[model samples]
Target: MHPFARSLVTFAAATAAAIALHAGEAAARTPAKPTIAFVHGAFADASGFGEVTSRLQDRGYTVVSPANPLRGPASDAAYVASALQPVKGPIVLVAHSYGGAVATPAAKLVGNVKALVYLNALALDAGESNFGIIERFPNRFGEALRTRPFPLPDGTEGTDFFVDPARFREFFAADVPARAVARMASAQRAVSLSAVQEPAGEPTWKTIPSWYLIGRQDEVISPAAQRFMAKRAGSRTVEINSSHASYISQPDRVTELILRAAR
Candidate 1:
């Protein structure tokens, strides 16, 4: 073979190999299925996110909606962060209501969390407590709650809060199905008062890119407060004309925001 022809063949092979290597690198950077970790707020469990979880699953995403414990903010955060220890890929940590307080610090503990989504959720800053912010931006839902004392694991007493069942639709999910709201009211988990008064952990939104979905008609967390927190965090925000349970009444809109964060 001619020396010139041999040189040309060698160069072509090298170029093809380099192109293959670059393609492999790009594929590695793109995750086929990113994990999404959902944290539910007070008076709710992982089941609170049932519809949203199903939607995400339909879109080829692995969703984990862990029971939030509804304990205190720090302990709840630690519980959620520990759940993520076994997950192997990038995570989009999504929170609802008080769950936002949990996700805020939990994200800091996980290195692979790529995005944060708050759905009518609390985005408390450092040194801030949920009740403190609620006091500052009072909502009608406060009037609807009925508190009762319950024995803790340590045998001490703790306060548990619940919205009046008759007023559940108005306070939490007026736009949701009546039957569903009825079931929710019957099965509602009580949120410990301590959880609301506890100071939140470090604000993860400071470092993580976040998206917020505000329930404009929310009586639980006033719309004004949601806007203030979202703006303060510099998050991409969208508003839905629904109750505090926007994810239930306006699932599409909520899912759209989550998809935006995942992308």
Candidate 2:
């Protein structure tokens, strides 16, 4: 081989080797993406998070959509905290509606929750009850809710709150497509009366960062109430023309807000 050609080959090999080493080092230094744990609110199940969860997963994020036991605030929070125990790294707890009441305390319990993302969710303060907050805001939501009696563990009857099937689409997901709204209305899960009535514990938002996506057209939890909580929690807030079921109706915007929190 000619002398100049040999030198040029050696220089190119060295440059390529250096670039590879830098790339390897950068990859090693990058932290793993946080696990996104979604907590669905009352009168709903984990399936509510399907679109957002799938979007996060597609971007290489580990996601957990745990079924929120619609019991009471304390117990539901405990259940969510326990469900997240197996997640190895940092967590971003995303809650909707009543699930926010659960995630507010559950985030603190998880110890590794780096952010709380509330999607038209209830971000209650210590000693503040969901109904207490709702009544203060005054919406047509009360007229849509109905209660059914069931036996509790203590052999006493307890109430499970549900949206009247006829009024479900109007109150919860008016912006969502008709077919999807029908599925949601038929598959609605009942949240206990205890869940809304129970007072929230110390909110995790004060300590951890928070992002809130407020639905301006929300009837279940009035936009007024949502704005009040977002201001009180000092959350990074975004608003959309949506109903309470923002995840189902406005998945792109909802997913974007969550991605911001995760980042």
Candidate 3:
């Protein structure tokens, strides 16, 4: 090729490369979509959020349903905080039941958490505990819980609480499909009694913009109790006529509330 022609080709290629580099830089500078980190309540694992997470992911949102240790609020919060460390950009933390307690303290540790979404979950204040609050506003389903002694890591005995499988459907997921409820019961994780009884640290909902979804038919956490906490936290509240497992039975609505918080 002629020298002039070769020079022109080289210049064109260089210009293209620079433009590509600039575009990459600009994309990097542009903020990414905030992640939705979900916390499952006691007697549940991240798998329980399959539908909700999938729907959120399909909508171009990154969703994480971390395992709640169900050890206690402090330790559970620490575990959740560690999970949040690797996540960049804004976060919309969603929790159900006891997970609310974990998310509350965990959010306090992560500045990137911009919103809190509670699905029939606990939203306790400083010096308050899941069990403590529940005690004040007792749910009839509380009578369905079955407890057994379990050995703790330190060799001491601690109580493990689970909704009796026979009553799980009636009290926890009455509105969910029978097949799914059966599966849920079989895979249920027993929450340590000590965990629910421990008091939480400062409540993050006090400062975070929060959204609460009340399951009006929730037997686990009575709707009345849910309202009390939502009102206390000044959360934007929505009521759904569902069970304690509204996120399972009404995942679309739950996901919608989560997206709203992400916004």
The candidate that achieves the highest lDDT relative to the unseen native structure: 2
lDDT digits (tens) for residues 1-82 of candidate 1:
9999999999999999999999999998876777989998876677878888899999999998888888798898888999
What tens digits encode model 3's per-residue C-alpha lDDT throughout 189-260? Answer: 999888988987788888899999999998998898999999999999999999999989898999899888
User: Could you estimate the TM-score for every candidate?
Assistant: 0.89, 0.91, 0.90
Candidate 2 residue pairs in clash (backbone atoms < 3 Å): none
Worst 10 residues of 1 by lDDT: 42-51
Off by over 4 Å in 2: 1-24
Candidate 1 yields a Cα-based lDDT of: 0.90
Better of 2 and 3 by TM-score: 2
* Clashes by residue pair, model 3: 97-121
Lowest lDDT 10-residue stretch of candidate 3? 134-143
Q: What is the C-alpha local distance difference test score of each model? A: 0.90, 0.92, 0.90
What value does the lDDT take at residue 199 in candidate 2?
A: 89
